[model samples]
Target chain A: MELLVASAIGVIMAAGVYLLLRARTLPVVLGLTLVTYAVNLFLFVTGRLTVDQAPVLNQGHESFADPLPQALVLTAIVISFGMTAVIVVMALKSYVESDSDHVDLDPQDDGEADS
Target chain B: MNHWIILPLLLPALVAPLIALAVRHDIVLQRIFSVSSTVILLVLGAILMGSTASDPVQSYHLGNWIAPFGIVLVLDRLSAMLLVLTAGLGLAVLLYAINGWDAEGRHFHPLFQFQLMGINGAFLTGDLFNLFVFFEVLLIASYGLMVHAGGAARMKAGVQYVTINLVGSGLFLIGVGLIYSVTGTLNMAHLATEVGRVDAADRALLEIGGLLLLLVFAVKAALVPVQFWLPGTYANAPPPVAALFAIMTKVGAYAIIRVYTLIFGDDAGASANLAGPWLLPAALVTMVIGMAGVLAARRLGEAVAFAVIGSMGTLLAAVSVFTQEAMAAALYYLLHSTIAGGALFLIVDLVNQRRTGYTDWLRAAPPFVHTGFIAALFLLGAMAMTGMPPLSGFIGKLLVLDGVRESSYAVWIWGLILGTSLLAIVGFARAGTTVFWKSAAVGGYLEPARPLAPALPFVAVGILLGASIVLTAFAGPVTVYLDTVAEQIYNPSGYIETVLPTSGHPEGVRP
Candidate 1:
């Protein structure tokens, strides 16, 4: 179970990082979303993997999962969800405004870079 | 629980939603509420700073829960000082904005208020997770503000800015998780106690987490390697918003100081002094890179933005030394740079607004309207930024130099700091000559020969520059106060005991 969760996080994070380095906005947005997922999962497992254990109090349960990480994960998910939405909207705006999805300004348009 | 401690956060939190929902259509009402709230915040911040000055550390437990299990807001001298600075800077920028910049976008007032709330909350919160949440609050609000008066260039830069921060936030969560998994508490005060108890085997994990968190803060502080996003974001952001953002990097610097001093300070056993080795070198490089960018910058705004990065470099280098005197010096530099950088940004915008076609592009255009006044403001700003005599910048640099004089890296610190100041002067001088002096030889005034901009913008810029002068004039008393603040920071036993009373310690983690 640990290996499964750990590998999943590693693979997703690796892919997210690769996509993040791309030159366009859409992939970067997708990359950010992917990284958020990996982070949420990583945060979730910080409590140590406890299967069949509840996060809440219940009768006769001998042990329980640490609920704090779950709470932390929920917050992370919401923030990342909202942020992804924001970046998507922003990416769409950039696409419409610049007529291109490239992440940087056109070489000549940025005066500081050229000079 | 003195409720006044929480008012700085609550004032902005309440007013932002009110402005957003009720006064959405009424820009006049929105400005009135926003400015009044900010003024109230400044007053509240002053009161809080005064209250904390001679007193012991204070903590506010949300929902009346005790420390380890519940979220907390801790108030010491450092947070109080930052709260005041944020409010003052926010008010100045808002004043400049209402002079015409706010009307260019929707919800500018509410977003500005939210930004303030986030900044204040970040300063005050004592929990690691809460800090992350407040960071998201500020970054999200900043995203909206970054593209507020949206242009293609602005939106593009906004995209890059949002993406980078999103990744930084991810790293922050990972760091927090790693730390929490090892220590089983997110309360910074509690973490300080728990970090000392970690086993040798788990020490590696804790260190990784610490360094990861440093990377995140370094990103915010715009330390080298992660410093790339700042120039684009600041140069493209609306000038007033950029000015307000002068406090934003300090948030990162503040976090670094807080976490390093409180959690990972001299008492953290194996994790002690974790940041110093890494932070010092990165900061030196950040200074060099920033000043070089200043020299290379073709636009006035970009040059100022690079100067901000350089200032952060200096501020964080002082912080990295981790002595009471150096920390105090860093705090002084922090105040000076925030005001000076902010004043410079406002002046850049004034130049941008008045010029006809040249729009802050550091070219020899005809003399723009009010060239003399803006030129004079730029001269003072340049003098302040380049560490010349009498202004707070020179005093700040000198204090930092003196503060770090005993360190083994003193030679490198002095060489880099002095070298970069020279670079900054040349950069600012060139831009100043081209934009202000060279315009004299161009024969004619800018076309259409516009009259002066509104007095409010000058007033806003004047207030900031005046603050710098005050900082310079009162350097003695201010440093005296900050020295105590620094003393409190390095010796954080007061902070921990206040946040976690003896009974407040929860059970240790099962791991």
Candidate 2:
């Protein structure tokens, strides 16, 4: 189970990095989303992998899983969702207005850069 | 148990939702509520500053939970000082925004309040995970504020800013995850104790985690090699928003100070000074790069943006020394640079508003209306920004130089700081003369540019510039206060004891 989770995170991060380096805005947004998924997994695993252990204490139980990382991951997921939404709208606006999804401003035209 | 420490966070957190829900469309009502909350925050911040000055360290655990278990908000001298600074900048920028700039966008008031909540929470958080959460809160609000008055340039910049910071946030999570995995705790005081007692076999992992955390802060601080996103984002942001962003970089510096001093200081077994060797060189290079950007910039706003980057470089270079005196000097510079940078941005906006064709471009265009008044303000702002004598910038540079006199790299620090100050002066002088003086020589008359930028905006800029003067005039008392703040940070035992009282042993003791 540990190996599976680690490999999944690695692969997701690899793909995210590849997409993030692209010159276009849409791919970059997608790349960021993918990377965030990997981050969430990493955060979740910080509490260690426990299949049957309860996150809450039972009077008779000797041990329970760490619950803090779970809470942290849930909060992270919600925040990332909001951030992705904002980025998507921003990318769409830029695409529609500039008619080019290229991320960098046009270097040849300084006046148009301001506009 | 002190409730005032939490007010800075709670006031903004409550008021932001209220504005969005009830006064979302009423600009007047939104202004009233936002301004009132910010004023209250300023008073609370001042009160906390005074109280913390005497006691030096206070912690408030949520819901009566014990330390190292529940969330905690720590208020020390450093956090209190930063709270006051954030409130001051927030109120000033909001006042400037109220002068018709708020009408350009929807939900401006709510977004502003949310941004404040994020900044204050970042300062007060005693847990690493909580810090990451506040960072997101601030970044999200910043995204909304960045593109507030939507234009193609703003949208493009906003896309880049959001993407870069999202990537940074991912890195932040990885960093926090690594630390939590190694230390088994996220409360900063507990982590400090754990780090000092980690097993020898785990030292390598702990070092990696520490470096990763430093990487996260470097991105936020706009340290070189990861600082490419700041210039465009700051330049394209609405002027008032850009002014408020002057405090954002300081958040990165603050994190570096808090985490490094508390968790990775001299006593952290293998992680001691993990970032120390690289910090100084990176800061120096960042300073050089930022100044070069300032020289190359074509627009006034871009120049100011680069100057901000330069100021961060200078501030961080002093802080990277990690001595109490150096930290004190860095804090003084931090306060000065925040106000000076914000003042410059506001002046640029005022100039941009009045100039018809040239806008804020640094070219000899037809003479702008109210050139004389704007020129004087611009000159004062430029002097403050470039470390000219008789302003806070000069005093800040002098203090940093004096503080770093004993370092091994004192020669390099001195040479780089002086060289960069020279470069900054030349850049500002050329830009100022071109915009204000050369234009007059070529056009010889004030063309009725746009009626004049309204008086209220000038008043806003004056208030900020006035604060810079106060910072200069009161440098002695401010330095004395920051000296105490730095002393408290360097000696983290008091902070650890306050936050984790249940751990009977002092901070460095292993359980």
Candidate 3:
């Protein structure tokens, strides 16, 4: 189980990095989403992998899984969701305004400089 | 249990939503409420600073819950000082914005309030995850403000800024997770004690987590190798928004000081001073590159952006020494640079608003109506930024230099700082001559196509510059207070004791 989770995180992060390096805005947005997924998974695993164990106290049970990481991961998920939404809208706005999807602004297109 | 400790965070949080919901369409009402709240915040901040001066540390636990379990807001000399600075800057920027900058976009008042809430929260929170939450709050609000005046340049800069910060936030979460997995606590006070007790086998993981966290802060601080996003973002932002952002980099510096000394100080076993060796060299390189950017900048706003970067490098280099005196100097420099950098941004906008052609570009264009007054303001701002005498910048640099004189890197520090000051002076001189002096020499001066900017904005900038002068005039008492703040930071026992009274067993320890 541990090996599976680690490999999954690695694969997701690799994909995220590859997409993040792309010059297009949409790919970059997608890349951030992928990286956030990896991060959320990593945060979840911080409580350690436990099967059939309650996060809450159970009578007659010697141990239960730590619950703090679960709460943290949940909060992180919601925050990342909001962030992803904001970035997507921003990318769309930039694309519509500039008529280009490339992430870097062309020097000539800088309005203040040209003005 | 002081309830007032949470006021800084609460006032803005509550006021923001009220402005968004209740007075969204009423610009007059929004302005009235926003300005009043900011004034109240400044007064509260002053009171907090005065109270914390003698007491040194105060903690407020949420909902009567104990430390390490419930959310905690800890106010010390450091947080109080920053709170007051933020409120002062926010008021100045908000007042300036009311001169029609807020009308450029929707929800300006609410977003401004939200940004303040995030900044205050980040400064006051005692937990790592809470800090992350506040960072998101600020970043989101900043995204709205950056593109508030919606132009192609702003949208492009906003996209890049958001993407880079998202990645940094990811790293922050991973680092916090790893630390929590090992130490089982996110409360900074508890982490301070628990980090020292980590087992030898887990020390490597702990170090990796700590360094990763530092990397996160380095990105925020615009430290070298991770600072590419700052110039574009700052230059593209609206002047008033950019002025508020002058404190944002200092937030990163504040976090570095707070976390490094509290949790990863000289006593954190193998993680002791993990960032110490690398910080100074990186800071020097940051200084050199930032000054280079300033010299190469083609526009006045871009030059101010690079100057901000340069100031950060200087401040961080002093902090890297990790001595109490050096920390005091760093704090003093931090306060001075924020005000000066903020004033410079506002002055650039004022210049941009007045020019008939090639606005804000470092070229010989026709002079505006208030050329002499604007020129003098720019000169004083530039002098302060470049560390000239009779301004706070010189005093800050002297204090930092004096503090680091005993360190092994003293020679390098002195050399780089002095050389950079010379470069900054030359850059500002060239810019000033091109923009102001040579412009008057141009024949056939044309009347400005636009009316002159209101005197209110100039008054706002003057207030900021006046504050810097006051900082210089009161350098003795201010430095003494910062000395005590630095002392409290270096010795975290008082902080920990206030946050967590029981040392051996924290309140929220899970069996």
Candidate 4:
């Protein structure tokens, strides 16, 4: 179980890094989403592997899954989605305003350079 | 009355859609929503503070499920104070928003009101997961607010800000997942107690998870290397919007304080596998660099951005030390800095209100009437930032430095307190001279350099200052309350029990 989760996380992170280097704003947002998936899973894995163990149940079994990480991840997923939406919208607005879809290195300084 | 606790969360959420849909057309309706919501928040904040001040461990278990299962809202004096500040600032910003709002029924007020829901919720939430929800709510509103005027510069900056923060959110999720995988609990109080039960050998996993969480906060807080997006985005944002964000940074600082104290709890030895020692030095360094950013910046708005960063540095530095005095000082100073810094930023926004001839510092210089008073206020706030005395700033500095001084690491305390203070003064005092005093060749006067007879906010600040001054005299008692806060946070069995069923108290405060 650990092997599967770890390998899956590695693959997700790799994909995230690849997309992250892309020049376009949309891809960067995509990259961020993918990376978050990897991260959420990775955090989950920290509690170690627990199969056939429900986090919600009776005692003396000496092994319930770590429920804390699961709870935290649920919140993370929802919040991350909200952030992704906000960024995507902002990027779209940027594209519309500046007529550019690619991320620019040097941000315009309110055009204060000339003044 | 018990259910009244959720009003802070509910009123904002309920009113937001109403404001967005029904009140979009009439400015009058917008004012009513904005004003009413702000007032409601203020009253709610005061009630929460008073109720929780002595008890200091108040919890509203949403659905009453108790810890290890249910979601909860916790209110304590520390969080109570911050809630008021957020509401107070929200009120002031909403008023400012009314005149500056571009069009009718644009849903701006609704978004602002919704944003408040997130902030106050974040402060009050007892569950770790809920913090993320609040953050997203606030972040979404901020994105709209950032690009409200639809300017190319802000839009560009907003895109970067969004990207950077999204990455941060991703990291945060990963951290949360890891912590759950290890701990099996999400309620902060429950986690605090259960966390201490883990084996020492397995501590590395928790440390890594803690670092990931810290990384997320570091980005949100805009600490050192992660702070590149702040100056660019903030500099371009409408002054009012940027001013609103002045308090936003404190959210990050507040999180660091909340999570750190809850999970790690005051230097628990090296074997405890805590996230403190590293954070302490790093926080100090963040401050030094933030001050440097202000010193290097050319423009006034950019300078303020770095100074904002500097304030974050101080707040986090106080948190990293994990001392009662330090924590209280961090809390007090953070509120003071946010309100004062936010007001100053608003004043700058007013400075750019586009009179026919007048402009920003770069475009032209304006006349000075009450400019001296404004300059003095900035100086006072800045002086407090430096830990200079008599004012609340001095009091805060004394508290923080005293905390570190009491600890064994004397050199670390001195280096951080003295060095950071010196750099902060350099950053603020220089900006004070240039922005307010050096009235240069420009077109004409813009908005109030200082209001003719002191506007509502100015008077409001005078009251805030007076309260803070009173705080200095009451520092000893407040310190005792803060000590209780630190104690309650560091050891949360009581909190966990309150959230849990009465049977849960059978273990009887085990940590």
Better of 1 and 3 by lDDT: 1
Candidate 4 lDDT, B228-313, residue by residue in tens: 77888788787767877887888887788777777666433332426577677667777777778767766657767877887787
Residues B1-511 of candidate 1 have per-residue lDDT tens digits of 7778888888899999999999999899999999999999999999999899667588999888989888899999999999999989998898999977888889999999999999999999999999999999999999999999898989999999999999999999999999999988989998888999999998988899999999999999999989999999999999988998999999999999999999999999989999999999999999999999999998999999999999999999999988999999999999999999999999999888777667889778878778898999999998998899989999999999999998999999999999999999999999999899998898787742244456899989999999999999999999999988999998888898899876756765454
Off by over 4 Å in 3: A58-60, A109-115, B507-511
The models' CA-based lDDT, in order, is 0.91, 0.88, 0.91, 0.69
Alpha-carbon DockQ of candidate 4: 0.49
CAPRI quality level assigned to candidate 2 from its DockQ score? medium
What level of docking quality does candidate 1 show? medium
Specify the poorest-scoring 10-residue window by lDDT in model 3 chain A: A106-115
Index of the highest-lDDT prediction: 1
lDDT of 4 by residue, A4-72 (tens): 878989999999978987889988888988998887777666656778886654567656665655655
Worst 10 residues of 2 chain B by lDDT: B502-511
The top-ranked prediction according to DockQ is 3
Candidate 2 lDDT, B418-450, residue by residue in tens: 999989998898889878988767775545444
lDDT over C-alpha atoms for residue A14 of model 4:
93
| lDDT of model 3, residue A28 | 96
| Model 4 chain B: ten consecutive residues of lowest lDDT | B355-364
